[model samples]
Target: MSHQLSDISHQTSDTRYQPSGVRNDAAPIGVFDSGYGGLTVLKELVKVLPQYDYLYLGDNGRAPYGNRSFETVYEYTLQCVQWFFEQGCSLVILACNTASAKALRSIQQNDLPRIAPDKRVLGVIRPTTEVIGEYSENGEIGILATKGTVNSGSYPIEIHKFFPEARVYQEACPMWVPIVENNEIDTPGADFFIKKNLHALFHKGPKVDAVLLACTHYPLLKDKIQEHLPIDVKLVSQGELVANSLADYLRRHPEMEQRCSKNGRQQFFTTDATEDFDNHGTLFFGAPVSSTHIVL
Candidate 1:
């Protein structure tokens, strides 16, 4: 399920745009996701870095990338990334976990150098993995994510790279995203799925003291998840972690920071019906969202 470099290089034609040439009209930082889940991350980014403008694109038309193959996810992600570049974005964040797991590396390694060497793209997994071990008392980390993310084994692999003694266990919650997207957080079905997945995760790794809600969409079900979680276990979400990481990143890379526009503006776009995106997006974003439609 892997694609060759030639397969995706054609999509990055506009990646060479220089920031200096467009400094007068600097573009907002791009935040992309498969659907509404990314709005959660965007919300935190706005809170921590309120001075900068941001553009968010959700590929709701071809979403639920959780079950898709690596090749398909990479292609869709690259296409969206290219769209961000065309919009004058010099930096893009793959806010979706499935995209981060399935496509981020290939896009960074193979496509960026040939197409947008000057541009930068980042993911949620690396930032979360870098600090995930510190939260665990015994280095027992449990991950609750989508099938694609779990199947990729990115968390365990990346965690091991940072914390060698850490024990990582994962449970794929395929039904959780659908439940959240459909606004079923309070329903019995939501509790059923949440308890089921948490049970599965703990059964395999009882020592898991900290559980990482690896999927952005999972935050909406936080209260319910905690209700069913063990009293002593810690629950970790990515929004704050990613926000802090981004702040540190900007501080470390002033060149990238200077390129980011700072009028405090925010725009939302979706590759699906705006009505649908706005309706569900508000719940994740914690505010009213007025979105426009865009064809990918």
Candidate 2:
């Protein structure tokens, strides 16, 4: 089941699939997202740890996992994790908040031991939650995310584990994702939705001094979000927090660090059209990207 760099060349009539020119025997860290949102996290990872090779897979064809059932998110995420293992990845990061909220624990606790004991999978939620309390002076935190992530209650649960004194408030921005994905962040429609959600979140927790953009895609709307936020409130995004936590994790576990390949190589794959992914992905990734199409 091992895949080589050359395998990326195999393509259908409608799409072009290109793999990295580097060799694949070395283990690269895998980054999985339900769609292009994960690119923001990957962008930070490369900035902080550019030497490590990375494989990013976006399940674009079956994306918008935000509202899916927990069982369905887990199933889709596990399948993508297996694909990363087949491609010789020793570690995978669930960069999507929805996937992380719904699937990460199940995969780490229930599936990894049975399928690949030596391999590891991490998520964005824990890292963000670990230090979220420090950003709030009032001990009141707000979470803005998709319906699935807010419904999962993962942030409140995990944040309590580390910062028991913190009170967490959540608001599901159902229209935010669609606004970002449609490249409408600069429009009046985007402003309306962003303001609506922010108002609702603050209404639930008026004393909230810090707000976490619990969804990866929300970072793209940071500017607009900040414009509507109270002047003193802090806006916390997961990209830098997750990146720093990952660096610390690798430092603490040299065995896992040694398992990661460091050749500065990166590859992108999508379950939908490469052209569309590349155009939208570049916006999120902060760099021009060319992606290959994958079926699963």
What residue pairs clash in candidate 2, if any at all? none
Q: Which residues of candidate 1, in runs, are more than 4 Å off? A: 1-22
Q: How accurate is candidate 2 locally (lDDT)?
A: 0.88
TM-score between model 2 and native? 0.91
173-264 in candidate 1: lDDT tens per residue? 99999998888889999999898999999999999999999999999999999999889999999999998999889777767876887656
Per-prediction TM-score, please? 0.92, 0.91
Where model 2 places Cα greater than 4 Å from the true spot, the runs are: 1-25
Residues 183-253, model 2: lDDT tens digits: 89999999899989998998899999999999999999999999999899999999999999998898776
Cα RMSD for candidate 2?
7.2
lDDT of each: 0.88, 0.88
Give the Cα-based TM-score of candidate 1 against the true structure.
Answer: 0.92
